[model samples]
Target: MRVSVVICTCGRASILPDTLDTLTVQTQPAHEVIIVATQPSDIPDLTRYTAKMPLRVEFAEKGLPKQRNHALNILSDQCDIVFFIDDDYMPSADALEQLSRAFAALRYAAGMNGTLLADGIHSRGIDASDARSMLRNRPAVGPVPIAIKRNLVGLYGCNMAYRTDAISDTRFDEALPLYGWQEDVDFASRVNGEMVQVNTVSGVHCGTKLGRESSGEMLGYSQVANPIYLSGKGHIPPVFLLKLTMKNILANHLKQLCPEDWIDRAGRARGNRAALKDWIRGRVSPDRLTHVRPSPSGPKP
Candidate 1:
């Protein structure tokens, strides 16, 4: 299979190079690496990597879904599988190789999400050096385990792959705007076949907090509004949406008491309230995030 890697990023120039460096050592090299950035400066100098791999950089309007759709529009015709990975993720050396094998075996799968050896998104965040160390020292494992769970709702956006043909008629929903919290779920649920999870195709999500363009308010609004929007669209069950909505709102409130230095819990809380109000007034929409103004005083410190 001819595999292409797509990375849609913005304001992550500082750490994106580390992710690119790992790709250089992949056991199964990608046919091409397409990077969609909002501006030239959003990506670091790539001249150094031009010789190591087939790399292409393109500019797009800011917004994760929009940037990803831009990549889909320009994908190489020869590409059979397109892997979407975050700018902060680091795949193991054989990840692509294993992913290809899994896809070959599961002929009916439309998409697949790789196992994450270490994910720092839930916590403070992980250092690139530390993430690299974890990847390097991970214990030798058994055969790759691939499963096609009928109930799988979505692929993890940090590291996921899809057959090129499966998405020939699909595009990431631009309605979800920047960060696009549940865009992956919305996309996967709309595609043609089953989604799988493969253990052998693993990676580390450093979840670097820098270069994030979404404010806590915007993210919080997305946390509530996107799920509701998707559920209403019939992409996700209403029960799942309700569970997700309450979980996020409850977490934000509980965390506000002793907020992490890196997180703006107060801003998120305020945004949550705003979204609830909008919902009650029948004005809730993910697009409203584009109109959300930043807090003048910034998030409570």
Candidate 2:
């Protein structure tokens, strides 16, 4: 199967090269690597890497969903399967090879997400060098195990793949906008076939803190609003939405007492409060997040 890799990134030009470096050693080289950025400055010079693999770069408006949709618009006609990985994710050498094997074996699966050997999104971010070391030390294993998850609501955005034909006409919803918190879930849930999880086709989500231009306010708002928006759209069940909302709100509130150095718990708590107020007033909408100005004290670009 012809495989394509798509990375929609913003900011973080400094670390993108390291992610691409990991791709150079992939056992199954991608047929093409398509990168969509908001501006030329969002990525590093790729002239040196072009000789190692087919690379294509394009510019788009900033939002993740919009940028990803732009990638879908320009995908090559020869592409069969497409992998959407984050700019900070580092996949193992055989990640693509295993993905190809899994897709070929699971003929009925429309999409799949590999297991994450290490994910820093939940804590202090991991450095690229540390992530590389972790990948190199992972125990050598045989063929990966694959399972079809009928009840999974979405694929992990950092390392997920989909059959091109299966999602050809399915465009990511642009409503979620920048940072698009749960855009992956919203998109994956709308696809036509079962989603699979491959155990051995793993990677590390460096979850580097840079290049995230969205403020804690924006993310916090989405934490509550996006799930509610998706639930109203019938893409996710109300029970799931309630659980997600409560979890984030509770975490933000509790963490505010002794916030993690890497997170802006207070700002997120304020955003969450605003979202709840809006909900009570019957004014909550995912698009409304775009209007919430970033806090001046929030993380820098």
Candidate 3:
């Protein structure tokens, strides 16, 4: 199967190279690598990356889901399998090889899940050599992909691959914009066939704040509102929505009361309050953030 990797990034210029570098060592090299760069300037000279397979970089209009949609439109006809991994996550050396194997094994699967972002040397920050050390010590997975339960929502947005044929004619919903809260669930739920978990296809999400926008107010609102919106559409279960909203609300409130530097608890609490107030007034909607102004730090709209 022709396999491709798509990475959408915004304001993460300094750390993007390291993410790209990790792809360079994939045991089963991708047929192509597509970059949907929200900030064209954030991307360094493409001429420097000769080791990666056929690389294509395009400047995107706006929003993470939109950027991903742009790439999927282009690659859907050209590739059999498409892998979506975040710009902040560094792939293991055998990541693509494992992904290929997983898909090849799951003959009827529409998509497969890759591992979530683990805190790998997050303090030292993301860099080329750090990725090398990360590969050396990355966890190992057995040969087979594990089947994800049917009732479970779906794949992780940070790392996952889809078989183009299995997805039928469905696409990522554009309603979930920018950071696209709960986008993974909305997108993958439309696809038919097996959704398996392949631990071998792993990556380290170097959670660095460098160049990225500080998401507080918008994120908090989305945390409460996005899931509810998806639930209304039958994309998310009310149970998940309930747990997600309550957990984030509690986290935000506790953080606000205690004042922690780790998370923007106070900002999010205020946002939640604002959203809840609007929700109480029957003004809550997924598109409520349509007019949110992108900060100077990241995600230009």
Using lDDT as the measure, which candidate wins?
2
lDDT of every model, 2 decimals = 0.86, 0.87, 0.74
Badly placed stretches (over 4 Å) of model 3 are: 120-131, 148-151, 290-301
lDDT of 2: 0.87
For model 1, how does the per-residue alpha-carbon lDDT over 63-159 read when each residue is reduced to its tens digit?
8999999999998466989999999999998888888888888888889998788898877788989988989988775674566354478888999
Top TM-score model: 2
Give, for candidate 1, the lowest lDDT window spanning 10 residues. 292-301
Better of 1 and 3 by TM-score: 1
Q: Which stretches of candidate 1 lie over 4 Å from their true place?
A: 148-150, 297-301
lDDT of 1 at 156: 86
What candidate 2 gets wrong by more than 4 Å, as runs, is: 148-150, 299-301
User: Which ranking of candidates, highest lDDT first?
Assistant: 2, 1, 3
Cα lDDT tens digits for candidate 2, 179-279: 78889988999998888787768799998888775488878889999998899889777887789899999999998898888888878887898889899
Model 3 clash tally, residue pairs: 0
How much is the lDDT of residue 70 in candidate 3?
A: 87
lDDT of 3 by residue, 1-301 (tens): 7789899888777777877877777788888999998777868766767655689988777788889888987875788889888887888888888877877776877788777546532243455566567668766678786554433467777787898887657878888767888888778877876676766677777766665446567777787778777888886568877898899888889867765454566667766776787789888876686544423342211
